[model samples]
Target: MTYPPDPYQPPDPYRPSDPYRPLDPYQAVQPPPPDPTPSYPPPYTPTSPAPSSGSGYPPPPPYGGGPAYGPPPGYPPPAKSPFGPPGYGASYGPQNTSAMAIASLVCSIAGVVTCISAPVGVVLGHLAKRQIRETGEGGEGLATAGLWVGYILTVIGVVTALFYAAIFIWAIAEGTNVTTTF
Candidate 1:
């Protein structure tokens, strides 16, 4: 068969390989962006005054000698405080050292003769020492000295009594007349 004298319409004249390469007529070209913003705060608000301090702290409390500055509507004032304890700081000093001293004095006679009373004197002397400690007193050495003295005296008295008793018995056993004056 014979070919047609001219082929179909020619190809596009504006292709990328053309002598003057053209941007697509349908698209737009734009420039790049600039730099950033400034540094700072926004703002502030207002306030009120104090009832007493003008800036607002509460007031100091009141004082007096009588009832209230005007008394309540009718209530009485508070009662006066009383002194505390049995003696209420009377003398404000240590107790007497005489407890042990008196016990020591009693021990002299009791220790020298009666064996039973001698132990009582020693117990009293110990109690006196405890009293001095509990009461911040002056009987420390006094009571100790008294107790030992009483104990020693008791020992001496007992030994002397036994000695005399032995001697008296020996006298009678030897057929001698034994007479004792109290």
Candidate 2:
């Protein structure tokens, strides 16, 4: 007989005793130290803002509708022909050959572009080349280039004029007032 049986007792429910807890995994994962120098910009978002200049140039203009602008302020515009101007060549600095070439190639345009302001692209081109060769000036290419372009343009204009004439003859026989589109 083991004395009177003692009753088994459980731990106290209200009072908590310290219990060992493993370290938190997140605590070990610290965000990398704040970057001292970021390599990339944070972000960019376009909202709404008018351009600083060209305010007059609309979003888009109808083809060949508005007047073409000349060179910027104080800058002289390209002469009528690349080879026309005595002082207009690129070897010294920036040249305007491209403009001259384009202008020379179109007879209608050449008249307005050449410094002499007439059907003189061919003549000017030759003179320009001569000047370039003898005096070491620039624009030899421009003059030679203009001569070819002017010739081509003349041929094109003739063909175009002939086509229009044929159309005019047909219209006259048909007696129809056909309106030519501008």
> Which has the greatest TM-score?
1
TM-score of each: 0.37, 0.31
lDDT of the candidates, in the order given: 0.63, 0.53
The sequence of per-residue lDDT tens digits that candidate 1 reaches over residues 10-102 is: 333444434366767885544333323332221212342334655544444455634645535334455566854566556756566756657
Candidate 2 yields a Cα-based lDDT of: 0.53
Model 2 residue 49 distance off true place after TM-score fit, in angstroms: 74
Residue 124, candidate 2: alpha-carbon lDDT: 56
Query: lDDT, candidate 1, residue 117?
Result: 68
